[model samples]
Target: MEVNIRHARAGVTIAVDGLAELRELEWHDGHVRIGAGLNLTEIERRLDGRIPLMAEWFPQFASRLIRNSATLGGNIGTASPIGDSPPTLLALDASLILASREGEREVALADFFRGYRQTELRDGELIRAVKIPLPLAPITGFYKYAKRRFDDISSVAVGIALELESDNVRRIRIGLGGVAATPIRALKAEEALAGKPWTKRNVREAARVMGQEGTPLSDHRASADYRAAMLEQALLKFFFEKSEVVRG
Candidate 1:
């Protein structure tokens, strides 16, 4: 029922006192399933960091020891503003299976998160599995912006997955975090990029609109002005990564 800071503090108090409590992880196509008891370290060794993206992103995370015990499912359930994977999974159009003693329900990533520290998940239910769509793009850009690169939660984090077709964005999904109450889609930005020439102009304008889409707070890590500026820049970077073509 606990891990990380609380577990580290409790030490002896937090133990599998009985033999009756133990479970294994579950996984399916392009996704993973697990009991609520799974932790981050077990996931790492289990996954062996084979998924290049997840592995690369791990180092930017706060703690290895915590990662050892911090379960992704738990984190998802917690739904913190700065939680890392929500934006990533949301951009990927991931689906989740929520289960209870009664039955199971599936919800889209976009709908799962309701607000800061809130999700659509009901009480007495646990996340059963995460279903991620296969990537349509060979190139993806995941950005986390904070004062320090390592172990710092971002003031703004952006995740975009794009599939380029004949120099245009044929398929696209955009996700943003730390700039809003919850990690959300930059749908306007996605529409702007789709089927159009993937040029810097379009990218800039789309990014501008994306920044305008949300009202971000001036937090300790960044200001509204700064976050807006970076969103624009994020658009441009994503564009270049997705396609070499330009709007000119």
Candidate 2:
């Protein structure tokens, strides 16, 4: 059943279907409060055309309708290895707000998921909202690849954030989705880019390392080789795209 709470000062809180609970909501800066019940469609539209921080990294998410009802908590709470949000959120260093019925609180983001479809959230504790620090945006983009570009789930997704410092990568962050049991951070790829001169060779080497980081499996949608190649191409394209933006 849907739970609704009427606040004296704040607006009503409606329990979102298919989620844990309607804990709370708040928005500040570029960050928004998301009750577990707040559906994806709502968040996507609200976030639409705004979260360009990882645009060059991975742009293709669910459609408007899908986004409308899909809860933000569902994406993180589902913890699906192939789910779209984790990798980008991981790359962006988002923080999860956990709440207990007793009013206790906890924060987790990095190193939260233990395995596929698993998370660190304690039982009966609900996700209040996630906090994302807005991007500084020197060279940032999201690149996602799949069999069908529009509606199909990704075979591999890359989220790369870079800061160009004097023709070299001063800083970089990479997040990979659908390449492993959980959306993953490509620390190796980031390391390869940092302090290294931006060039085709460096990008290729980083792509190689990223491929190694993936444990892509043969599935109905894709073969292991295709996933690896997709990651390689995605990373390469992201490098060039960001290079252009940062150079400009």
- State in Å the error of residue 234, model 1: 1.7
Q: Per-prediction count of colliding residue pairs?
A: 3, 15
Q: What TM-score would each prediction reach against the true structure? A: 0.80, 0.81
**How high is the CA lDDT of each candidate model?**
0.70, 0.71
TM-score of structure candidate 1: 0.80
Model 2 per-residue lDDT tens digits across residues 38-134: 6655554456646665343223666666666666677778777777777777767677777777784646566778787778878877777777765
Candidate 1 residue spans exceeding 4 A from truth: 1-37, 41-52, 241-248
Q: Cα miss at 206, model 2 (Å)?
A: 0.9
- Evaluated against the true structure, the overall lDDT of model 1 is 0.70
